[model samples]
Target chain A: MSLSITVVVVTTSTALHAADKLIASATAAGFDVRVVARTGDDPIADVVKVAIAASSSEYVSIIESDGWLSGEAGAVIGGFLASHPGADIVYTDEGTVGRRGRIDVIAKPIFSPERLRCQFYWGDIVLYRRSLFDEVGGVDASVPGAELYDLALRASIAARSVEHIAKPLFIRSVQSDSGLGGIALESTRRALERHLASTGGGVVRAVGADGVHDTRRLVQGEPLISIVIPSRGIYSEIDGERRCYVVDAARSIMDLSTYQNFEITLVLDSVAESEVISELMAIVGQKLRIVEWTKPFNFSEKINHGVLHSRGEFVLLLNDDVQILEPEWLESLLALAQRPGAGMSGGMLYYKDDTIQHAGHGYYDGDASHIGLDAPRTDPGPLNGYRVEREVSGVTAACAMMPKALFIEVGGLSNLLPGNFNDVDLCMKVTWLGHDIYWTPHAELYHFESKTRDASVHAFEVDVAWGRWGFRMHDPRYWPYPHNRPPA
Target chain B: MTEITPDEQADYERDARQLALVDRIIGLEAQVAHLRSVNTSQALRDQLKEVKSSTTWKVGRLVLAPALALQRLLGRNADKDK
Candidate 1:
């Protein structure tokens, strides 16, 4: 029988005192453990190697001295392995104890080539097969503020696929002075630069670092826009026909917009009722061209399919229920998103009472999940805004637009997030690429329609969110996590 | 004798004197109307007794506070420039 677990405690003189509780927790969990410290010997790589070498168990996980493993973590991993013999690695979403204890995740979109460099890995509650770590040669502490990031990057590139247990298995707490944030940023930039050079793409060119202030000036001449809507039998609720939204949407677009340089494409999946299709076709005049697919209801796959069929430079992933608030929203959103590192942009969300649903996007700390964009609005300014844009850790899929190139680079959206929250994962992955995700007050939409609530959280939604969150670290950038936007 | 016939001069002087008398009567009539508006009979009865005694009721701080003390206190604090 394989040894149950090898808990490797990584310590440094700087924060060794911080790890006392975490070390004790590992011991209490009945882990056959190794506590290793590096005085001047490069702590990270040394610990990862020692942890891998000492383990005889089928599983291995690196526990930073400052991180606490959940009491039930050992049992959860043990059962997961028993169930998934072919699994190479199993990770859990971790909650960190920082200024406050918060849980954050690695989003799904990060599975793409953007993480090819050692710097792009963010959340570090890792549990892996010891053989794989040995094959990849474990962590390299020489990267300076980006040690484990390099190790995880090599493993992700080497692995067949990574599996997640969707539980809070590891607790990475915050100490007075943790280098996680600065290190994570360095890791991501290195990854992007590597991926681009490897694929013959040049280093990120400088354009509007100031901002693409006017969308028209940025990508002038209305580059084509393909609007995609996923349809179910919930037709009337979404609108008259899936097409009526397309029509009213087109009419609303035409009526609200002063600019005339655009076209609309509607992605119609096989809704069971003929009336749904007929209703859509009758209402959508020359304004919309419809595309039909018989594929099952996988939201990400459907979006991926829509992306391939589209010929536009920008693709707006929109829900059917939204009504136009600013007629020129496309121009404004396109303007902001058109900037150099801007990966995606979303409109403000409102409840029927004109209260805020979301400003752009906010994050979840372990205590709670899925906080809104500008919850209970404060002084109108970015606290640590990277640039002029209020840089959020992530954005939601409800009404977000992206440049096609960046979308493709992040591997479109994740097919695994069948019902919900694939967008948040995509948002984190793109932002990690040194790109900014902007939430615009100018681009506004109201979600009075509640079909989205059906998947507000299914079991898989919870599981995917928990698993995807396996990568995002809890830091000040997402501080006000578990916070709400001041209702508008 | 040529500059003015006695009867004509007398009529002219009488007309000038009558015009001056009419102007004086109009001025007196306006002053009486102002006094009538300000002087309520009931209030004046009490003030008259005080004024007769020279104990109250005054217009300016220069003197006469003894004649209209209450009236001076009740006067509006409005500025005179406007």
Candidate 2:
């Protein structure tokens, strides 16, 4: 196929140099560049349209102003599109351009049209024939933030030839100042429902039939994970003095067999005693990391601070109390967490006596004003977590694996929450945004759960049981009360 | 959205291939276990037991997982923190 993938950058009056850098990068990759800037109040669609018309190529790709295209992006993109002629448009795995340039994660979508509805999230880095726009239609120019997802869904449904490359090639800039804005996601969900309803449900059948990388499957090329065991105090309440177990946590970590990629994250919390730090250093040997945190008590706070100091994308938010149950715990967890729609994922929690602690989470409505709570006790042998792939309302944050950005996006466990409800709050907020939470039975961890010692030991759980309404306020579907009885 | 750079493309391909290799190795392990479990001859069972202990697999795995995990740490963003 004779293809010249021309990148179209729509520049505002200001960002010319950044736009030029993108053009130069694309040019270096042997792609033709066409600049589409604001021309006297012309709509952005009109601009993109004129640029697409000007490009005399079989395939036209797009790179917006303040955008990035990594090394040799064009050929890979054009090849994906050419190979899949049924696809109307092509998109690469979208993420951010951090200090390291590109941090793209596996895109795993679990809830299809049933619960979580749309995938046309970012439209800027998509590649398609110029004729696609000319034939069906183009961006409406009237819709707001989610305009592209809407337009692309329409075009994709109409043309049925839209496709995507399995590589990470795009970065949708983080609008730092925007926060979550005033838009309610439930309202967006309603709008999406209306849109989906309007198009008579233009959902595509067989999402991974194209034979490119399946969006639901996790990519496997990353190396082993190495964690830094920070110099945190290993204090046991059993004695006034600090302690280490017969088999230390660091040594236990090294014992894991499914260990292709993993690292320990050791942080030197300011409060950790020097003796304990020294002992940890002795235990970890080369694995100890003396990280800096401005002194925080909450487990969520400690983990958030520690992760910022972490190197692995697949982070293990392990508590000092938990031990690996089996050798395949990690690979099993990663395999499950790698599934689509799983933003914050965790697994089966068991007690030292081998009883189930938590297989998944729901909000506690009984004793608390909506602190995150685990699913009411279930027999671990029956494998409640292993049932099937389904959307969950919340998950235990004590041993969750999620993207660092998603953690930051949820405001890193409200500093005001101080204790028990923080992880609940984080999971609720995540699910509220229409993302799914999952619990897998395969990744079992022994949780030495010390709720009393848990920094979030709130009197509010007792108070809420007396009067206040709890988890019912946000999503009543996940309310857990005192009796452990299902709401009849 | 970002385009998949060639480096990332190569990385994905490599990761996929490595995971596939592990999957295959696991299959072989299961097959060996199955054959040993249903041994027809006492001599064959004894040989299997000896081979299970004497096989280079245990030593190879003991050294590899930690080493791989260490190399993986260098690729992460928190190399300095740990």
Candidate 3:
């Protein structure tokens, strides 16, 4: 038996020619074609509904007037649907075709709810199960420019399974523009706010004109956060002056951070200088708890010891070389960590020279590395990856946050990895247990990396990590440019 | 034979190329899974090597060697008596 698809082309009087071309192409490609005329009187959503109501098919695809089906869209979509039997909603990678040919190929990631809230990354063409469309009540006519976005959010909430096809199946006949317009941005913001309100209450603030947003989930009551820092109380030369990194880190948190209901658990080396401890105490005041590390220099072991001594609902793993850059950095991390299905949350870290240190971790080309390393902090990166809060394969433990219970549940960091790749191993463990690790640009910090210890990676550590998680070396979320873009 | 139009030919070639691309993507996904399985096997072997070279394993072997020799001697004596 074959699955049937109805292609509903929404068009206006001026773009009827393009609509005709789309109808012809869809019909030739073995899809049921329906055309809906968007008069100035009726809303676009109502017009689409009329067409959908008239058509009878297993699947319904909504496309704009200027968009047409690719030559092999039918074959690819059929094959995908056959394979993914449980998928209720499916969207494909899309590109714009002009006289110069195809360009701006948006190779979308596998169903990211966080990314969806920030922007309408899913382009114009979307295929939905007819039943799912009806279940989500078609679309809201009130959201003028973001009708599809609103529908998508509601459908995602109700969808049993949503899948993404990396292949570009939809072709638009115009050049894509940068950023959402005024009305569109406002509509998208409203849609996002409603999405948050329906799922869980959160306030959405538009970050920039590029359709990026910051979502602050209403955290229920102030949860005491335990910040665990493993330090040797060593001094680093900054601007020709010797400064204790741990003391400075503690001072930055005390002075800069807006969240006050927290304590700092410093896992100091037993042989640390008395002056360093005294400085840390004076800076952190009564909120500091010190735990002496008598064992050898094992970063994972020290963190585990610190967590054992501290008491908080959540645990924040901070490196001593880091300084808080934003007043609301902790607030951003905590809100995301408190969300449902979140295992860990991390922040963007910059180097001393204002270059990106860690945006997130990606296991590309069979090696774990930071996603956007050494790039200017102002760069919007590929697919706005550095600008939005989205799910990642792993996050650096240097500035990561998670529930204390979850930390103990994943057995903290692995002892086998004493120093290097311990964070990656911990992230892998969290992902293995089916929890999402999120990275947000909203949380900002500066990491004076490798200030206290040797940063060289060892061969044995690589062997151990690859031996355990070699299968998961490929990251699906890190779809950067040149990899996803079509031939120019 | 029926003559095919140039436009129809272009469509056919385009569709064929796209279908091939889809097939290639599917093939790559399967290949990645196969490679992952192979890598996991190699990793297990490496872990086994590490365990075998561990001090605890060496000490266990040393302590069990004398017990095994006595058991062999006792077995031979019992067999001779029988």
Top model by DockQ, which number?
A: 3
Residues A1-488 of candidate 3: C-alpha lDDT, one tens digit per residue: 23488878777766688577678778877888888776643458877888888888888877764666788777888899889888898998877774557455667878888777876677767888999999888978877666777888989999999888888777775543545556666777788889999987788876446656766666667999999999988776867998988888899999998889999999888778888988887898889988777779888778877776678999999999898989988888898898888999999999887888888887765677787777888988876788888878889999999998887767677666788998987887788778998888988999987423366677877766666677777776545332221101
Candidate order (TM-score): 3, 1, 2
Query: Per-residue lDDT tens digits of candidate 1, residues B1-80?
Result: 01335785466446434433433343344345445545488887997787866634333433755546656555533333
For residue B29, model 2's alpha carbon misses the true position, in angstroms, by 52
lDDT tens readout by residue for model 2, A451-476: 33434356763332222224223332
Task: Please identify model 1 stretches exceeding 4 Å from their true place.
Answer: A1-221, A233-247, A272-287, A367-389, A473-475, A478-481, A485-488, B1-82
Tens digit of per-residue lDDT, candidate 1, span A1-488: 23466767767767677778777777777667676665543436765675566567666666554667788876777787778787776566555554444555423222322222212323455666778877877775555445555556567756776776656666764443243444444544454444444443434322121211111213445677666665552345433533444434444555676445555556666563566555555554454555555667777666665665566788888766566777767876776577556788777666545555566555544322333433333323222121123445666676788887777666667665666767866775676567877655657666555423444457775555544454353433433434543211
Off by over 4 Å in 2: A1-219, A223-232, A237-242, A245-247, A271-275, A282-288, A292-296, A364-390, A450-456, A459-488, B1-82
When summed lDDT is taken over every stretch of 10 residues in candidate 2 chain A, the lowest stretch is: A208-217
For candidate 3, what is the lDDT? 0.78
Candidate 1 chain A: 10-residue stretch with minimal lDDT? A208-217
| Best-fitting candidate, scored by lDDT | 3
Model 3, residue A261: what's the lDDT?
Answer: 95
The first chain of model 1 has a TM-score of 0.49
